[model samples]
Target: MVSLTPVDIEGFTFLAISVELPKTTLLVVTSERGYIMCGALDVGLLNERLKDRKILAGRAVGVKTIDELLEAPLESVTHEALDAGITPGMLGKDALLLML
Candidate 1:
C-alpha cells in the first residue's frame, strides 16, 4: 500500500509518499529541488553503487532501515546530492531540504 500527501516547504509544494511492501516500507519526498528517500534504501550494492554515482547523482538519498526509522547513516547518494554538500553521515532529515 502507498499513501501520498501534499507537502509545503521552502515555498515549494511537493509530494510525499509512504510505501508498504511485504518486507519493508519506503518513505519518499520529491520535488524539483531534489528527492529524499529511505527505508530499504537499496537492494544490491554493486549495481546500486554504479547507478548511484550516475543517474541519481545528488538527487537522491538512501539509508538502511529496520522497523521504524529515526536517524540513520546514509548508505548512498547521487552526484547532485553530493553537489548539495550531502554525504554518507548526514541525517536523513537534514539531507532533505524543506522537510516537515
Candidate 2:
C-alpha cells in the first residue's frame, strides 16, 4: 500500500510517500515545489543515478523518473538531462533550495 502525506522539514514543505512492504518500509520524498530528493532503498539508487546523469549533462541538477529517463549506452545519463534541458548546476541549486 502507498500513503501520501504533507510534511514540513526545516521549514520546507514536502510530499511524503509511505510504502508498506513485507520486509522494509519505503519512503519517497518530493518537494512541494516538485523536486525529488533522497529516499529509501531503490529510491536512493534512483537519486544516485539521476545525480550522475545531471553531472554528465554539465548541469548541477535535474528531475527525472526511472521510467521516463532515457537510457544511453557508452555515454552517461546526460541524454536525459539534455532532453530535459537541465543543467548540473541547476540541479544542485534546486536541490539546495528544496533543502534536499
Candidate 3:
C-alpha cells in the first residue's frame, strides 16, 4: 500500500509517500525555487541513474530510508546538488533548500 500526505518542513511543502514493502516514505518537493525527490536505499545510485535524465525533476536524493532521510547527516547528493552547497553531512531539511 502507498500513503501520501502533504507535509510542511522548515516552511516547505512536500508531498510524502509511504511504501509498504520497503517501509520507506518518498517525498516529492517542487517549487519555483527547485525540484527533487527524497527517499531510497542508496542515494549514490539514485543520483547516478538520474545523472543523464535531465528531466523537469532536476534532482534525486537518497536519504537511505525514511528515518535516515529526515535526519540527513549523511546523503548522496547529485553533482548539481553539490553545486548548491549541500554536503554529505548536511541535514536533509537544509539540503532541501539548496536543491533548487
* Model 1, TM vs. native: 0.55
lDDT of all the models against the reference? 0.53, 0.38, 0.53
TM-score of 2: 0.37
Best by TM-score: 3
Per-residue CA lDDT of model 3 for 68-98, tens digit only, reads 4555553455565666776666765566666
User: Model 1 misses residue 38 by how many Å?
Assistant: 1.9
Per-residue CA lDDT of model 1 for 1-100, tens digit only, reads 8888776555556676778888766777666565566634452442355655433312233433321122455566666566677676665455555232
**C-alpha lDDT (0 to 100) for residue 50 of candidate 1:** 61
Candidate 1, residue 79: how far the Cα is off, in Å:
2.0
Per-prediction TM-score, please? 0.55, 0.37, 0.59
Stretches of candidate 1 exceeding 4 Å from the true structure:
7-14, 43-71, 98-100
Q: Each prediction's Cα RMSD?
A: 5.3, 11.2, 4.5
